[model samples]
Target: MNRKTLVLPAVIGLLAPVLAACGGTDGGSDGGGAIAVGTTDRFIATADAPAPLDPAYAYDVGSWNILRQTVQTLMIQPRGEGEPVPEAAESCTFTDTGNERYVCKLREGLKFADGNPVTAKDVKYSIDRALAIKADSGVSALLSTIDTVEAQGEREVVFHLKTADATFPYKLSTPVAGIVNPADYDKGKLRDGFEVSGSGPYKLEAKVENDEMVSAVFTKNADYKGALTVNNDKAEIRSFKDADAMDAALQNGDIDVMSRTLTPEQIKKLSIDPGENVELIDMPGLEIRYLAFNTDAPGVKDKAVRQAMAQVVNRSELVSKVYGSQAEPLYSLVPATITGHSNSFFNEYGDPSTDKAESLLAKADVTTPVKLTLHYTTDHYGAATKQEFEVLQKQLNASGLFDVTIKGTPWDSFVPAQRKGSYEVWGMGWFPDFPDADNYLAPFLDDDNFLKSPYANSVIRNTLIPASRREPDRGSAATSLTEIQDIVAEDVPVLPLWQGKQYVAARDDITGTAYVLNSSSTLQLWELGRGVSG
Candidate 1:
């Protein structure tokens, strides 16, 4: 859930002008010939290339992107929008009035890339294995409501939940629920390496590893029988050190497509550079960047201290100065694009108030020049992150009420360190598992969540969430979402910073930029192709 995923930009008001000004074009081949797509050459060992392409263990965006291409889930968010449709399953539905039981009927003649039959047993094994391994970064928490998964005959899979959960189907759409061949993977532990056995549009042909980097080659899976259409026979994905390098590769024809991590300035440059022959696809802004406070850390243990910290920070300034127009101020844990989202923080604290912050600190008996350490990942959250934190440091220290020390570590070390409570306050970014407000709430606030900080709220976790899940009508859960937002604003365990716009730059010859992005902001590799005309 904390992974930094890629996205395709949509033709929207914010980006329409940019696209028009740039003489925006589509990606397609000239007539009929093969096309080669390239990704970043720089990959992080932990975040990008941690091995075993097992859906149960793949957590980061890089891993998920590969899994999305190769694995077949019972349901999927096709083109990344709406409720998930049947992928491996011919049909899926909730059977009982309480909504506790769910069932799926497998599609006929389904087979893996290896030409092995895909049965209901494989579906049961996949879910069971994910729960059993329980990797720290895995999506087991999303399935916590499931009590049992059983296969009925060869084509049917049934799930019995401990409680009613209307959002259960959405979980099935994520890569965590991807079906794997039981014969090729272990049921009790993570699969050993990068080798993957799946039933999707593409199959992994080979992988090349470099220093701190990995590149994968995927060919069309002849046995693929899913909703996705394979436009190209093959694709090559590589990791890059940063967006600039990725952009350079794309401009130089070293790569055919570029997604994720492009700075606002880079995007602006691309927008006006007609000679680049790159099409910029704009997508909705659903990604959120936030600051998480370790409640156990000194100088932040007091609730008043946390609230004061929130009051002093200016989200608008962060967006304008650091993020430019690529992001917007986010005042709640849930972004405005999602249903049930509320600007609770804005209502509670209003604009940046030095007087109010000082008053709150006085009430907590906090002395001026309160010393604190702020931590962030140097490489993970993009190049702007360092500048963003520096801006925050200056803003917090400007009041003469705080002594802030900025600390940064690479993502590999940063994730574990933050989870272990090694940082007092830190920055984190989230790409949704699904396009729902519940995703924003559950992952950060659930019991023993990814935050790994000593913080808990019974009403939000034990009460509001379960109540919301039981509500058959998702819109009716607005009351619970509003209450949860209000509670989070009051507690200020995590400060909502900003939400980002998605951008994907593809060569003019690439045809499917429009279809590459789904609602979840995940790029569909199969949708990309070179037009024969190019």
Candidate 2:
């Protein structure tokens, strides 16, 4: 499925650069100086890319979380643990009239950035376009039940679902259902990347093609009726290639914040770096890094073959050598941050014992010289991905059980190839939507999952997922997901290698850095500003 890549307005040429310096402010106090925020602006924030700026198209939590505050959803997910609750809509009622008909009443005063009051019509148009385009992964399947969305009135949108989906409201909380400005889109496309606008708190200050893109915060819109989180007056995003450069900029007083994973090696250096105010905030990350098998491909289709490969992965060695203990060994695809996460695979295979792996492979009749190509992304994640794969290849080959060939691709090509079942085995990572166990299980277990792993166990797929989804309460759903985890543990289609620990080194002058563990990918732009006392 080659979806059309949306060509957003080219990122505008670099605007006059602002001076980067630091100052202190108390809660709700304006910085009076620039607050520089940094990230690796690897991908242009656009709809055509794997991750886009629009809530409707952005899949990964990295960009979507930023979009969440900027663009309001029909329902807002609570920033902390637990099930998603309503935000933009006062209440949504589902009528068991078969086709999963859901009627929602919007909270008063909701409006887009353009000052047009948000109405039922806008929601319908946003959802309809998603179903029509279906190329952007973020919005397509999430709106699974929406057969038709018709405006019942100005404040109410009625959704006629295609099936009896009881968990429809949960889907509404996701950013994919974000309402868009009708005037900005052209036949399911965005022409003005620079002018790209949303109903969110901040607006794009200017767009640059692949260069630095910036945005500024405004007082809550008079038409806007949702909750606002940040206390900062404005935010400036400067994209960098790696954490070192980001740290360097922070040291030079070129940026106010550096919020992303810096390797453990970098952490050690930043701690001692002169003039670098390094802060270590350890919150549960919403992301999971794993080795996915192309189940459709030969050699990987066998469970023992997959398990043998899984057992050979020396996670400790990978972490020690490549990540330097910054990451924890993983057992299942589920990250420890989520409620129902379990070390299911670790409970079974904790050590990288080649003898045990060989026995299992022998029992399954897998002979020596088992060979396959391992693919990894060169530009994504961090510098350690390739080293991680290199270490993996050495461990497996040293065992004399398998021979390995490694291939590399950039994140853009790597994503499509992995999704389209193009690789035999590949390295991949995930950042969950709302810190739920179902996000780890349901998205990966589906026979047609994005990773293209068709590991469909009826127990986990049909029953466990659907059951978890129906529970309005996440606690109950987590129990169901635990059962799903056990099933996944039994059939290891994907090997959980390690859980990443995010490392951010900020200048000592920056303060009010609070980690809300709910959305691991969010920077919580409001809670941060210049140091109140330093």
Model 1 poorest ten-residue lDDT run = 15-24
Cα lDDT of all candidates, in order? 0.79, 0.65
Model 2, CA-based lDDT: 0.65
Off by over 4 Å in 2: 1-26, 45-51, 91-103, 136-139, 145-150, 159-170, 186-195, 210-223, 271-278, 509-511, 515-518, 531-533
Error of 2 at 122 (Å): 0.8
Give lDDT tens digits, candidate 1, residues 393-468.
Answer: 9999997788998998887778778767788899988888887788899888887576775789988988999888
Off by over 4 Å in 1: 1-52, 210-213, 532-534
Residue clash pairs of candidate 2: 9-193, 11-207, 11-208, 11-209, 12-207, 12-208, 70-200, 230-526, 231-526, 277-508
Per-model TM values vs. the true structure: 0.92, 0.84
Prediction RMSDs, each to the true structure = 5.3, 9.0
